[model samples]
Target: MKNIVAAVLAGVLSLSLTGCSVFQTLEGQTEDKPNEYSNVYELSSGKAYVWEHDGETDIRNDLSQDRVGDPVFFACPLGDINFKGDELSDIDQYPRSIWIPSDIDDQIPTVTSKNALIYISDTTVPEEIIFERFADYGYSIGVSNMEADGGGHYFITYAETDEDDYKYYVDMKSEAAQVTEFDTIARLYLDKVGGMEVNEDTVSDGGTVMNLEKDKSYICEFYTGTFYQDFKLKANIHSFGKLERFVCHDYEFLHANCIKIEIPDWFKSGYYFVQGVGLFRYVTDEDLLSYNGKAFDPGINWNDPIKQYDEYGVCIFDPSLDIDYEDIENISDPGLDESEIVIGASPEEEEETEGSEIDESSEGSTLDSDSN
Candidate 1:
């Protein structure tokens, strides 16, 4: 009886080992599956080809014949328009905001004059769906100018929250969008923290690249505001003693609808926090140039916006020798990671006559982090 029992136990152990081996083999295969990242416009042939490297063969021939059972990610074309000029705005196409990482492959260009509004295929979905996929995957974006990599490795980092077994995150693919000859040469949008001024004494929520890690040298690219208020943090970039690269920017970003806030008239004496809003976008030349003389409007389209950054319009502060928000590049600041980061806004501007002032927006909205 003892011998029989030993044999059964051994058999069971063998099966368990075999199962584990099989499972590992399957996982490895899935992980190694030609992990390709391409912009929606790059799939010129209107199909996802077997892309391998930066320069893959044409995608038209890459249609998987046997893999028809697999789910193919397709970008839906919405608010279609065929632009016919050199300059194209959402006025001629979909009027919403799109953010791309700073260290994106130059091969994979940002919204340029060529393919801003162009979509690869007709099958596309709304930006909301894309954002949902990003949140569900717990994707975290990072920007750091690693002292290594021979300088210029300042990458718009992408990774999953799961450090142990990170399976998925946002992998850019072809998506349908309006296409036309007119191209959007450049793009501007608001994110977490955009205000009229950023005082020198104010600490960033990781919005400026120089403010990213406390250890790096402080060249001070965009954080040049002093005195009172009305400056906000912009993009983060990598600087190895060279011209900075534009990585990403933080503007006040909110999804869907915001909760209503009604300030109590009787409660305007001391410190009162407004839960509904936060910083405003920094005023720029583009804003003052608008036909309507209003500073940038901090509003949302609810569902569909009308033009480029129509919701997060540019600010109206008059320009000076001071560095504007767009001047900041790919330097990342931990403080500005979330768009809901708040600023201290007093009805009156702080005194910049001395130097930079601290973020003492006492009457401004307190950090209503819960609203986020």
Candidate 2:
């Protein structure tokens, strides 16, 4: 899950909050906001939310030749780990479309068009932060210059180079080089990163995995489109002993019935990370209604890199709990296919006999899984 503080610690600049469901951006926190960002406005939990002031600021609308003040970039806490108020409850937690734990290892393994790590700086800092955190991911980043209303420099431009073909920072109170995590709602907006091509291949199935032990029961939540889905999955020390089940989905964040995970031999008994696919676009309720099954980015196998973790965390070991897999399955809607058949796999791989055809009948068919 993408938390306000977790993202900062991971050094990832770009982020997306809850969609239509639970998408509440904090507005007024005068006392809590840091003075460094000019105290324009504040956000709870240090969430990276974009905002705008009155119509007449120094901000310039790249879409139009309008003038205004620069947008406010709320510089949140970098090392916060506390969940306030409603976040303490599972139902009230902000819904993260893709709930993969933010993972950045020391060595840069591989960087594909599948995903790119973005880093933006609020204040002027060393360029080494970008190199150490994001550059090696095959993403070329550079800064440009823009004009601020006041004497302060506003650097926002796109200078493409042969080797490094990407832009990184844009600032308001620019002393020199500047980068930001927040983009204005009215002015130029840059979403998505790198040269990755976004198409139907970006949207597909969804599933997530967690580590568990036998003799333990768990409560899991999957949210989407203003719906908070909560269900139970338990395992005893016997045939269950923390069974790892993989549920398939048609769209990311689809609802599900109380379907217990059924783990097979090859799937193993360790921490299981299940995910359907990666959708590059935001899925609203209206878009879901018109889906004709032609759009989706059939992604990687669930067991490609091993275990997955998130700050939202796994639910288990609560004494005030009583539920069984069978009982939960009865209440849960039937799940999609429980196998690792991927859509984007090569034609030869798709020809496999088992787990071949997808089960699209299940309502809770897809999920936004962040498999690292």
Candidate 3:
């Protein structure tokens, strides 16, 4: 009787050890399974390509110059810019005004043909900085040379917002827009800030670029205004530091729909956004000549030919050759994969074990028959 009892106990112990070994082997197989995600690079002929790198995928249009996206229409800080004739009246004292010439003098430093318009603003900026209105092009260009003190400064320009056709963009801020169709070259000036967002907390005071990490620089800032009267969007831009084929490469342009403020009311200002490039503090009129290195013409026409091209000799406003902007979806963030590990026995395995019937060929069945 003692030997039979020892044999039964030893058989049961061996089966238990075998079951644990099988479970461990199954777990090890699961852990060795290949990851589902893999790197994929798909090129659509030569126009565009989808590249997956380090678990992240990016889709870019290789030929993004043939088409231009429509501009976001926000009210200019000057409200509706009016053409107040050629001269500034001594009696009419406005806060901010500038004389933009349709015909300028190369030597006289004045409007030669007396074909000038006065652009007056009431909402933003000091008298030192003025916005030149390009009537034919239907936009305003502003520049500043002020330092970024505690209050901050900005240089920004945009298309006309008061036109009845663009009433849709009057109140839009921080919204996504689709480029349904290809636009003309004339539309480039109007398409300054595409898909841009400016919140009330936008920081204006430019931070130190040296303190920033590699390949990073200050873009723009949105901060609460002085006396809490208004919110400010200050953009510090530098243009053409590097010569490149595309104007987009000259400066880091942001695309977002703004919120709260209709126009960026720059108080303390520096830098300027114009001709698809951000100008630094000390920009002269000669610096605003042609896109490529055209000699400075003092009599440069503000609206002679609205279209500007890059050094690559391609139209700046041109969109991609094959793909449309509507088809390209905006991907703000990348999706991350998650995994879970199970310990001991899984719930399903435990349930199966609890409900399992005794096997007739097993030692347990033999032990039961012997007992009987």
Residue 307 error for model 3, in Å?
A: 37
Candidate 2 to truth, TM: 0.19
Q: What ordering of candidates by TM-score runs from best to worst?
A: 1, 2, 3
Over 14-119, each residue of candidate 1 has an lDDT whose tens digit, in order, gives 8787775545556687432321233322343332222222232433322322223232222221111112131112131211111232233112211111111112
Give the alpha-carbon lDDT of every model: 0.22, 0.23, 0.22
- lDDT of candidate 2 over 77-116, digit per residue (tens): 2211112232222231221111111121111111112211
Total clashing pairs for each candidate: 43, 38, 24
lDDT of model number 1: 0.22
- Model 2 local distance difference test score: 0.23
Candidate 3: global Cα-lDDT? 0.22
Best by TM-score: 1
